[model samples]
Target: MTEPLPHPQLLLAIAALRDRALAADSLNALGFSIANDPYPLLQYHQALVFQQQGQSLELLCVSGLARPSEDSPYLVWLQRAVRWIATQLDDDQPRWLGRDALTPPADIAEGWAEWWPKGLWCIPLHDRDGQRLGLVLFLLDAAPAPALQPLFEGLWRTWAHCWASFARQRRLLRWRPGKRQLLLALAVAVALLLVPVRQTALAPAEIVSREAMIISSPIDGVIQSMQVRPNQPVEKDTPLFSLDETTLNSRAEVLGKEVAVADAELMAASQRAFDNPQSKSELTLLHGRVQQRRAELAAVKAQLQRTQVRAPRAGVAVYSDPNDWLGKPVSTGERILLIAEPKQPAMLIQLPVADAIALEPGAEVTLFLTAYPLTPLKGKVLETSYQAQANEEGVVAYRLLASIDGQPEHARLGLHGTARLYGERVVLGYYLLRRPFAALRAWSGL
Candidate 1:
């Protein structure tokens, strides 16, 4: 059933209240778009929102704009105001504070107060759980404008809740270290300086001979036999390998027959020169032919002598295996094997360009061979490449040499290992962050 119609004045009041409710809903529905509005920001000069973050408050926006990351003069001046906000009553609400009464406790308080002598309207926002959030501030003019007071007073508490909710979603603005946290950070900084760290780099290494001589094929031939096995101890003049001598012997027989024929012709030409004066020129030409033939014969013989390869000095034949070389055809200058002393085995390292570090002569080197990983080898850096180039694995690297302090009994040529090169002592922090800091500096051009 319908009750009696309300009085006209009562109906008007009801309509006004409905309008206010609709306005509040519209303002709240504006959402984040309010940050882009120039009218409110221009009229208010600046509107700031601060939100509660973990253990601290974050500044969300100022003058319809998102807060900047850089430190500003305003934040330095607002420190006192922030402290007051932190210690406010839990039941605090919005209010207006005059610039004269609200004295900021900071070194620049006089200048800061002068700039805002007009005063500021403060709105204290709270969550539904009754927890005090942060504040929404608006700058005022020299003459106190009470126009916005009623707008703030008449609105539903939910209207203010929107600003609080938004502030909570913004990025943090500032960090202030407490006494305990400051002390802990200071202690850590000191410890980082005290710790001793070695500046080091890593590279792949291999066992190498210090006074090794490479044996190469002097003449093109197929291997007939392996006179000495790989890693076999041999004295100077020991037969290392014999090339196939079938061609050498056949060619020698042909040369011998040619030499005999040339000598017979020269003797016959000498007799003819004595009998016929015109034949003397022909006799001299025949003698010249004989000499040329002898020179050719000498060269063939010299090559034949080199068919049986021999060690130049007393050392170990450093080839991989006999099966690898036997019956295989080799060209001139092709390396067959090495003759290493085995008395001094050094380390050859290929330091990649990305992992390069400054190394001085006599710098310490620690290496671990794959065969004897349990035992590490100590060495001293002897040399480093002046440039970067590709290594055996086709990776860009710098060649480095290090001489081992002592030789191991089981050390063999071509054995692979990992080597660590030490440069100098550095603070723990610098040692750890050196690369990252360098990269940052390069990218930022700082």
Candidate 2:
């Protein structure tokens, strides 16, 4: 009696079951089926995927044909087995089927019982050109029938070919370029090569003298009025502001009376001293009184001056906020304004620390203003700070002063511009620009 080839329907059912299990998205579900199957001598199963960037195989999935438990001996052995296989593949050894088997330890069956009770099967996934892409490992739940080998092998072959074709298509898609893209890339490469780099120059600068004065009141009084605004330019002795001088005037009157009395006394003592030398003591005392009165008068006059603030120089007036001024009856030592000389303009250039180190007091530089790009100003480095300051970009640069030959017609303070420093220049032919493209071609194997 011919045992009808294991019923075709049964074979179809078995194939479908295997396919559905393999297609499971979750490893836990796959493990459940492998565990529940009544296959003794069950061992481990794993899948390894190739990483193109690292050019190596890494474990993608793992399952055991035994119960899941942290203390399971099989788990430890399986890990060790995977490690051994990974080492072999990483070295590109011929012992591992030359990348044919995705799973590590290409000879899975030989070392299977050493780690577990049963053997394992490793299937390699390849592309259409037979390039290895990944691997799959399976542990038997039972001694798989000799007949099962052919069935499983056929299943692996079908999936392997499909995966390979898909991989080949992906590789081809990456290399394909559209017309617009090709043109845009070529344009960028040409621009990088053809554009001439410009040289940066330093700007001019000058040193200006500065001074400060403290304006205090001799008499306590309320603020009468403010005569100057912040940043109002004023010349030396110019009226900065005024204060209420009523109290000061009263004190001046008292001091004047004392001075007059002292002067009369001194005169009488001097006449007496001339008539009689014995009255010299009284004369001496009178002279001392006169000196004291003179000093008092001088102090009164100084106090009177405090009532009116004045500029000490022909510069811009700088006014400080009232809150910052130390509490006093009137503004004391408060900056009213700053007067800067507009005729003498200086150029300030901030250069990177590295570049600044190369610059000297006489180094020449060219300056260009953002507003007037047509005009290029020449300047000579006059001074550089010993210390470096951090610019807005957080890069440390040295502040340099340069003297511009002639200020631009529309030059203004706080203008934005770039300074080009003429460093060593190199001469190269225009055709040499194509070197980068050639190198890229070699790298891409195109």
Candidate 3:
């Protein structure tokens, strides 16, 4: 059988609708075209268009209306009914819907009599990929002609493509925050900055004796040799080191010879006193000279005895390699080594002046020794220097003394490591910005 050809006027209406859908610049404009532009081809009492929003359908346009009023009863019922309808339709194809054809839930069925016609055409709009994007409902007074199906399918395809493109563009655009949202975010940031945290600083530290006896050079002379090894245990009166006694011995020998000469001259002058009265006056001068020489000789012998230094108390000898001290000239009272008790260990920290933070006595300190970095030792600050002094490394730093909390086996004297010193609690912002602020103040002199 030959199918009747589409009327020329009807073909013109479909072309016009397709052009209108293609020219749509926005989702709203496309929705309006979908809802009202096909009136000439299919005489419908009203048309409604909806798009998929998450798991629900959102009504975008209503025929003959500039904008669908959200508060309208008809729209309210239609939104719920349409969501129900979308779930029932398994395939993205044009179909007819009637109250008798598919029984809706009680709530939707109650609104049908007042808001909808007894029968309507539901056309699902699909993008090129075959994914349903929206739905268009047409409430026609009479059944749509079979010839109109092809025209409607072509027009809906154009509408779906335009809608999908707009959707993709909307998703790509960034969401600009309103004034209230911005203020809320700022408040949250301020709150985070106000959180309290412990202020901490890291500095070089070493394990030292808490109450070690200082071993210093007794006299000004070159060191001859070390009597004991570094870190070797020593008993009281033990020989620790000795100075070069060559100069002292030579001085003593000279003084002794002078004393003997003075004594011999005195005896000779005494012997001559009996023979000649003039020699009696020389005897008194010679005797005085002998006494002065004897005193000088005694002083030299005493200094010679002091050249060999001994440990004043029993403890371990703490110092650098003995080779460093041999032949080194040392002044009187200059420290050379330490006689430290093994049990009395403490931490000595050299915090650089630039990194110095306010610290109180008894502040918590954690020591990470280079020898045993995995196991950290805990301690508390006992004292700190008021002024910055140049350390062994030539860095100007404040000296801090800390006592070990417990006698840890690894807390051996002379061990070097880094110390993390924790001071008073402060706001997180202040803790993080303290160093930067200090640098800025120093640079700006303010």
Candidate 4:
């Protein structure tokens, strides 16, 4: 004998239910579809969907509602009823449950007549692996025919697959941290931020001479030559550099001729004074003119002597490349070089304004030389500029001087390094946020 063909409406209803279940992208959406989408295939007064939580069922959705309200009397009663029924079931399957078969607790029994119909068809949902997914309760006026059990089972199993996938996806997509854990983590982070830390700032530094004699141009003239090379040791009165003497020599020669001419005129007046009494008066005027010319000559000679600069005391010459200064014109008192004691090298730091911190005299400092970075040299702040100025690098910075604790063999004049200056203690949060706060204040003018 051939099997009877399924009804066209039943086939359409089954296809529709399957389509909705497959289309659901989230656990909540799947629960809603499961609760309401089966109405065409199976006529029921109401439907409730539940998810299996450890040892109990959690009411997930109710038919005809987007979401089941937690405080709804109907939902609250269904949750208790479904949970109790889930525990009483012996195996994972679909079956018709009569209201009379259940000896519910007093709380549940009191509302049974008012809320439910004669019976409900309980369908247990499971994944392909036989893991229990949840339960679906359909409140029907009459028990479903046994022949439809296979169709109901097949539909719920398909939904279980979708439910399992959505549940796994939901867990992977977001982290649901508990309230206590979140609070504890936040508390720990805040405490760490409040920790006391020593504030420090880094600046470009160079080993320099302390209290060294500064060599400057004595007159406004062009530099002719440098007698000593950079870092060359010299004794007292050693020739360091010389200014161009071509003009000074020419001026001196003219002054000398004027002095000679003044003397000759004075001699003639002195000789004629005996011959004419009027010449005596001329003699005094001529003598004054000769004295004036001699004074001018003396001044020129003094300037000529100052053209050749010499070291006043014994030390090493500290300056940049000699080629930079050669042929360069300099004004009087302009710094040319330094006669520095190499053994007493100090640190010259150019602290950028953006990285500037509260610094005071005698504050701790550490020097990390580019050449010998492994061995750090300790120092103390000797002086700090009251104002900021642009450095050689064109960065606006404050000039700071620091005294080395002890003389190191490699600590010589003109050696460059990085200086870490330590300031007063502050909270870690402030130390990290100090720059950001300063930038914000500057931008917002607050």
**Which candidate tops lDDT?**
3
* Candidate 4, 1-446: lDDT as tens digits: 98677678776778778888999878888899989888866789989888888777888888997766788887678767777778766777777878787778888777778988988888888776777888888999888866676766668778888988976786778988899999999999899889999999999999988869889999999999999999899999999999998988898899889999999999988888898998898887888999998998898789989999999999999888999999999999999999988778899999999999999999999999999999888999999999999987899999999999976888877878899999999999999999999999999999
Candidate scoring better on TM-score of 3 and 4: 4
> lDDT by residue for model 3 over 5-74, one digit each (tens)?
8888878888888888889889888888888888867778899898887778888888998876899888
TM-score of each: 0.57, 0.48, 0.60, 0.61
Error of 3 at 267 (Å): 0.7
**Candidate 3 structure lDDT:** 0.88
RMSD per candidate (Å) reads 14.4, 11.7, 19.3, 14.9
Which stretches of candidate 1 lie above 4 Å from their native place? 1-183, 186-196, 321-324, 327-329, 437-446
Worst 10 residues of 2 by lDDT: 91-100
Reference-based lDDT, residue 442, model 1 = 90
State residue 226's C-alpha deviation in candidate 4, in Å: 0.8
Q: What is the lDDT of residue 93 in candidate 2?
A: 14
TM-score of 2: 0.48
Off by over 4 Å in 3: 1-182
Which digits, one per residue and each the tens of the lDDT, describe model 2 over residues 1-446? Answer: 87336657657755765675566444334334333331322223443332222445544434432334535665545555655554544321112232322444445544463543343444555555656655555543343555555555555554555455555666777997889999999988767766554333343322221233444443445556556655556678887656677777887788889989998988887788888988788877888888887888788788777767666667654446544332336444443345555445556777876444256686776777787778866767777788898877787878877666774554444456776655323223233433565568879989
Model 4 CA lDDT for position 118? 81
Candidate 1 matches the true fold with a TM-score of: 0.57
